[model samples]
Each structure stands twice: as structure tokens, then as C-alpha cells.
Target: MTLDNQHWERISAYLSGDLSQDERNAFESWLQDSDSNRLLFQEARLVWESSRIKLRVKNPATEEELLKLRARIKSQQPAGRIIPLFRNSALLKIAASLTLVTVAAYFYWTLRDTETVIASGDQVLTLYLPDSSRVWLNTNSTLSYTEDFTKENRTVTLKGEAYFQVKRDTAHTFEVVTPATTAVVLGTSFNVNDADSATIVTVAEGKVRFAERDAAREKDVVLTPREQATFHHRKKTMDRSRSRDMKFAAWRRYKNVQYEKEVKNSGLYLATQYTWRKNQINQSVIEGTIRNSASLAVYRDIVLYVTYSQPGGPQKTSRLVIGETVNPGQTIDYRRRLLDIFTETNVLHVKVESAEVETGDHY
Candidate 1:
């Protein structure tokens, strides 16, 4: 029997024991009318079971094996086949059918078809975690997670600043990976800022272990609360600092643009803010954006320099370091002034780091 919406619904209701006595009798009679209906019902249940096998990784089965089983279903060449009548005799089959339904319901409710938010300067975002760990994203940063995040392991890769207040789950430890550092927490609270390779992990509650990425590009090291770990991605060096930002701990309360914290770039490849007040960098107040249009504001005579080991060789190293912010669109003799500044200050590859704010001069 070809199953339509109504037929599927009837089959589902009968399997779930939702059908009335009269409806159940009718379904049983209908079930006997066509062996095709019975075959289809079993086929659908098996499909549900196969999808859930991934969640129960303890049991292993390949798609090819399942497909072979599906092919064999056509062999209704009934030899030893028997449909038990007594309800007690069908207990195991009923349990398997209910499990398929339960898993299908869970997949429908839990898997969110979305992407992670990675904000930059003065930006805010919301993140939905697999274990129901909700994160309030701050600005000048990026956050990303795959839909299949928990299939193998509970992990989310990130770049450029955001704070996390994790939900505890002992079965799987949540790991935050940055280019320079790794913050591993099972159920604690912390802030992980990875802006242009200047990675900082500050723990507020419980504990977290901070470490560098392994040669296989996996997380290493661990950390505890009231401690802050800093690392430079390119330099491959670890730096430790005293915890100053106490607010980095809180979760519910958030930041609204007062334009505080003049964060030092600290050889930060991307622009960032740092304060020496020995104050706290709360997990609640972080923000920023990646500037695609604003690579640099035209300042001086843009001297294009390239290192050539030989003729027509691919240029090797480049640098652009700006002393401070300048008025936008101001023309500069990059040749006479900018190159001289590069020679004297050793800061070259400079770009305009500006932000667009609606109704304010915050950026």
C-alpha cells in the first residue's frame, strides 16, 4: 500500500497505542488487507533506527549494511516469518518502535539549522549550544559551530573575541579552541578572546585549563578560574597575567556602548583593546567586527614595497603598523612621510580601523 500523509499518521497512531479500540480494530483489519502496508511500516521504523545509530556511537553499523538489510526486506519470501498476536509477545518490537519515535522527536527539536556568530567591534550576537549552553556574544570577534558538532565530539572552533558561560555536562567536556590558546571547561564560566591571534582566556567561575593548539591543530593545556592566560598565535609564546576583569564572569547582564577599555593591540594582528587597570574583562561585555571594506584609510604616499629574493620572485614579508588613528580620507605622501615613519618607527602595514555606529561616535 502506498503510504500518504493520512496512512502514515494512522500507522504512527496504531504503533504508539494512540488509536481508539474501534480505530485499532480497523487498522489491524487494514494491516491484514495488504502485506505492503506491513512492509512499509517496518521500513519506515528501520530508517528511523538507522538515523539514531549515530547518537548511540557505542553501537556501530555502516550505511551499506543497513542498505543491504533494506534490500532483503523484499524477500517477504515468508519461510519462518511469524507475526505474534499477544501484546506481551510483541514487547521488544514495541520498545524498538517507540525508541525510533523518541529519537525522531529529539532530532526535530534539538538540531538547529544555523551558523555561529563572530562579531567584530561593537557587535553583539546569540549562540545556541548542543547541551543548551546559551552564549551572549560580544563585539570585534567571530564564533562558529557545525550542525554536526556533537556527532564525534562536543567542540566549537572560534576566532576573535566572545565570552562563554557554559552549561555543565560530564559526559562530554566543552572545549573552546583559539589559534593561540585552548580553554577547556566541563560546566564552568569563562571568556575567550581570540582577536587577530592575541588569544586570552579568563576564567570567572569553576575552572578552565588554557593551552596551545597541538601539531595536529587540536587543543592542549588546561586552566582554572581567577586566572588569565594569553598567547600569541604566530610567535607561539605563552604569556600569563593577573585576572583584572571581574565582570568577565557574569552571564545575564551585558554591555551597551559606553566606549570603555582602551585595549592595547600587543602585537595583535587585528585591532583590539586592553586595559592595565588590573580590572576585570567580564564574559558579559565583549564586542567587535571584521572590517572587509575598511582595509585602510588613505593617509600618505602609499609606498608599495615587496621583498624579492630573485627577479619575479613571490614577495615574502610585509608589515603595516600605524602609530594612532587619523582623520579618514586624509591624503598623505606615503613616499616621503609614511615610508620615513616606517623607517623610524618600524611600523608599516597600516590600515584604517573604523566602525559604523548608528546615533553615536563610539567606533
Candidate 2:
């Protein structure tokens, strides 16, 4: 039986689990119609398995072997033996081996040209590049680098806003390419915002060479710390100015503070001081202060795990959420009433479970 594009698509969908139950049943019934159909399906499964193999390291010498195999297969293929299912078992093995080699060659070619992509949606994301450089991607941002990154090149393409702390490499300068402009630096921390109609570069440390995408070297501006540059897409013009405030990179600092708080929150940076008592109505009343000890971090949305025990019974844990903010070395007090607790219930422990860093985006 000869297979068309639709048959190939059906076979692929069946293997990938994309067919519905009814469609799957019909396809299986069709597969049972003839011996040739079963043989073809088996060959297709072997090809699918070959495609799933992960080829991490490519050997350059395999190109010659692949070429020789292709030539051998081509010489053996005749119009009369196009399907080859009825052929001898030895020829069938050769055909399967050729399929595997073809898939391997395709993977090698694709991996050589593949790019590493990192994107963020509603929340911020932090990533480390192959060169050990750190990047904080803001909401709706995308960053991609080629496979040759940190080896033959140290360049990245950006689509929204991101803060980059590029590693110092004197020999290879790091470059950030946007639609309107490009920023190059040896080692620096900077923010790049590529919006709808323009691209902005704000330097926090070191120096950045900001220029139009297709501009001359002389037209590029070297911006030092606290300097900003803008490139307008419509007019294709570039401008430079000094920024008094460093709020352009506030997102990076906010994310870093949150990360530090999470890393040091286990009885080190955040602590709870509280007192609990039984009210007149026999309800549990808890009042306390959540203190942030970090010198530069602010925390909010504190969630406390309250563990209580009944008279001669097992302990039960309840969650309490405090919609408050605690600054560095500052304490925020909160009061919560537990109405479901029994009159004789005792408060055993109250500990800070988690808290979110106060991130106010100024950009």
C-alpha cells in the first residue's frame, strides 16, 4: 500500500498521541487491513525512535560515513523495490540503518545552528549565560543567543526590557543587539529597553558604546555610569544624556533583594515576635510583628504557618496571610482572629513560611 501526505500525518499523530480515541481506533483498524501496512508502520516507528535520540556531541568524521551510506542506499534503491516491505530481511535491515543515519545527520545540522532562547511572561526571570554573565529579564521579554555563544561570540539579542551584568572579558567584548540600537561593553551592568518605537540603554556601571544599528563608529556614544542613550526607530537618530536617578534598573535590584530574602529567610533574615491569647468570646487572638533583618531588603505579603494543638490531641496547622510590608530593620505588626479553634485550644508555634519582596517598578 502506498502512503500519501495525509497517511504520513496520521501515522505521526498516532505515534505522538495527538489523535482522539475515535480516530485512534479507526487508524488501528486500518493498520490491521494488510501485512504491508504493518510493515510500513514498523519502519516508521524505527524512524521515530531514531529522531528521539539526543546527539549531544557531534563528530565531524561522521559526515563522510553519512555520505557513503547515502550513496550505498541510493545505488540499492530501484523503482520496483520502492516500498521494500516484501524484500528480504537483510535489505530491510539496510533500509532501517539508512533511516537512522539520515535522522542523525539532520539532527547534527540543526544543532549546529540552533539558538538558546529565554523568555519571560508575567513574572521576571533570572538566567546565567554560558559566559557566567547574569541577566534579569523583565515581563514580556525575550533573550536569545546562538550556540556559538561564549566560544566564537559573546552577543545576545533582546526584545523587551532586561538588566545584564556582563562578565568581564577584555579579549571579547559583550554585545546586546536590539532592533534600533546595539550596546557593546567590556564589563558592565546596564539596562536595555526595546519598546515599540525606540530602544533605550541605561548604564549602571562601567561604560557602554551605544550606537544606531547601522551607524558609523564615530557616531556612537560612550556612556559611563548614570548615563543614558536613546535610539528612535522612525527617525533613525541617537541621543545621549545623563540620568540623575538610577531607577531604570530598579527591577534588577528588586529581584535580587527577593532572591536574597528567600535564601536567608530560614531563621536568619526574617523572624516573628508574637503573643497569643484567648478572647472573651473564646476565640484565639494572635498579635505579632514580622521583622526583616536584612539591611537592604523589603518584604511584604507575609505568610505565617500557625501550629496549634487541642487539649490532649494532635497538632493542627493553619495559614495566616498578612498583607503588610516590613522594611529593613523595621517591624510590622499584625492581628488575626482564629474563630474555628476550640475554646481550650493552645497555640504551639508561629513561624514565617514565606514572604514576597516589595518590587515597585519605576521604569
Candidate 3:
């Protein structure tokens, strides 16, 4: 009932297009009275402006954006082009009904004392939890847990994909909950992929038990090193297979082997850069060659081939990028020195006398 912490929530709701006309009037009045109200709206704009939250949308976006879209409608009202946006019967019904659900959930989650949602966006995110366990989230994936995660059973939710090199704790089993099933491991490294209805749990070291729970059906499967268990939800069955766990999950190590992929309109190799800034990238430059169809397979090994102009040793790379795709995001590591053909020291480069790779797989 009071306008304290809830003030920010109201502003957020308004920015998200969840507030009704009457509620919008109330918010405007509140904003007029308090300077902080305007400031708070500015902060919420950051979240509303982000592109990450768009992926969760069930329908295509017809409006420009939350605040910006609504602003456009107001500015273009005289032209009627923007008035139709607010008058759109379909969008009004959808926004009014759906706003309560999403905004409420977002507000509650943000107010919670614990729990966090970590995502890499277009880059790979590295996390060192309180328990000393290391988690590498692939591009376009999410890893979330309560702030007191390790205190409990080490439970976490996985969306998209990630590779884990968990610290061994037999007393506290690490549980990964995907959309389909749960994968439990003692202390080991593994790769988990969520492909719609099925969850793929691949174990590289130690052992893991995957539990599939449903009202009418329940099953459990134990996987050893170099093994995988795929849990299908709709059919309520699990399929198990063997894989080279270490080799398969090597992407977690920030390894990459760039090769020849046919050039298209954008034929140049793109050099990757990163920044800690919230609104924009601090730096970006063209650093490497873009491969074309002439090149075949890239690196299958987990090793790294990096170069640097400075006199620094090979102890650490300024940037860290992965060679494989665990999900949809594409990330380039910082200070990534590639042993590329462009780089004179690359051993993989094929010279005129060098044997040609008849088959791409041979590389």
C-alpha cells in the first residue's frame, strides 16, 4: 500500500507495459512528486532495453519496445499510426493479462534475498561459486541458483547448455534440474544440454545418476565416465549412450581451433573483444581470418594455440573463448591468441607442399 520499495516495482511495471491506464496515471502523479521516481525509471530502462529478455517471449514483438515503444505511440498519436498501437485490441488484451504474471514473477524474484540468474548473453560466462566449484556457461545459456545454493544440496537449474567441473562433495550431492530430468553427481565434470523436450546429461569423470519423474512414470539411470543419458519427457523414457566425456566437454576449457570456412559477403575473420560495461561493448576489432569452405574440420583436441604481441608469457590469456557451441550464443575470449595461418607460427596451416586434408574429418 505504501510507495517505498514498491515504488520501483510500479515504475518497472509501467515500463514493461504491464500497468493499466488508471495505474499509469497514478504512476505519473507519483513521478511528478518525487525526483527519485524519475531516477528509478531510468534504472529500470536498462532492464527493459536489454535484448536478452526478448528470447523468452512466446510471440513475436509487434511494438517497438517497452518504454520506447510506448513513447513512440504517444509521440505519433496525432498521426494515428501510433494511436493504433495503444488501440490494438489484440495487444491490449495480451498485455493486460500477461503483465500481471511476468511482472509479478520478476518483482518477486528480484526482491528475494538469495538466488541469481547468470547468463553469458553472446559470450561464455565463467563462475566460481562459493563452494569452489567452477561452472562455465556457454553462450546463450542460463545458470541460476539460490545465493545459499551450496548450503543445501547444491541444486541448480540449467537452461540451454553449460559444462561443469564440480568440486567433489559426497556429503552434498550436486543436483542439476533441467526442463526434463535431474542429473545428480558427486564431484565431476560433465556437459548438460537441454534440447526442448529432452535433457542430455553427459558425464566425463566420476559418476552421475539421472532421475526422470512423472506422475505415471518414473525412471533412473546411472552413467559412468564417457557415458550419456538422454531423458525424454513426453514419452517418459530415457536413452543412454557412451561418449568421450572429456573430449566432448572440452569446450568448457575455452579451447578453439579456427579453420577454413567458405567466405560469404562478410569474408573477413572477425577479431573478438569484450567489456564489463552494461550498456555497450568497450572495444571491438577485426583480429583474425574468417575461414571459408576451403577449410575443413577445426581442432578436435582440447589444447590451445594462442599468440600475443606483448612480451607476456603463456601463463594466462587476456581473453578466453570457446571453440564449440554449447548453445545459441557466440563468444570470443579476451587476449585470445590464435595460431592461425595468418599467424606465422600456426602448425595446422597447410602450405603448398603440405599434405592436403582430403577429408575434413582427418584434421
TM-score of every model?
0.36, 0.45, 0.41
Runs of candidate 2 with Cα error greater than 4 angstroms are: 1-113, 253-363
Off by over 4 Å in 3: 1-111, 213-218, 244-246, 253-363
The lDDT for every candidate, in the order shown, is 0.47, 0.70, 0.50
Question: Which ranges in model 1 have alpha carbons more than 4 Å from their true place?
Answer: 1-122, 215-221, 248-363
Worst 10 residues of 2 by lDDT: 79-88
Q: Predicted candidate 2: what Cα RMSD to the true structure? A: 19.6
Cand. 1 Cα-lDDT: 0.47
Top candidate (TM-score)? 2
Per-residue lDDT of candidate 2, residues 70-141 (tens digit): 343334323222232222243233333334344445445554456667778776777889999888888888
lDDT of 1 at 179: 49
Global fold similarity of model 3 (TM-score): 0.41
lDDT of 3 at 48: 41
* Location of the lowest summed lDDT over 10 successive residues in candidate 3: 346-355
Give the candidate number with the greatest lDDT: 2
Where is model 1 poorest over a 10-residue stretch in terms of lDDT? 282-291
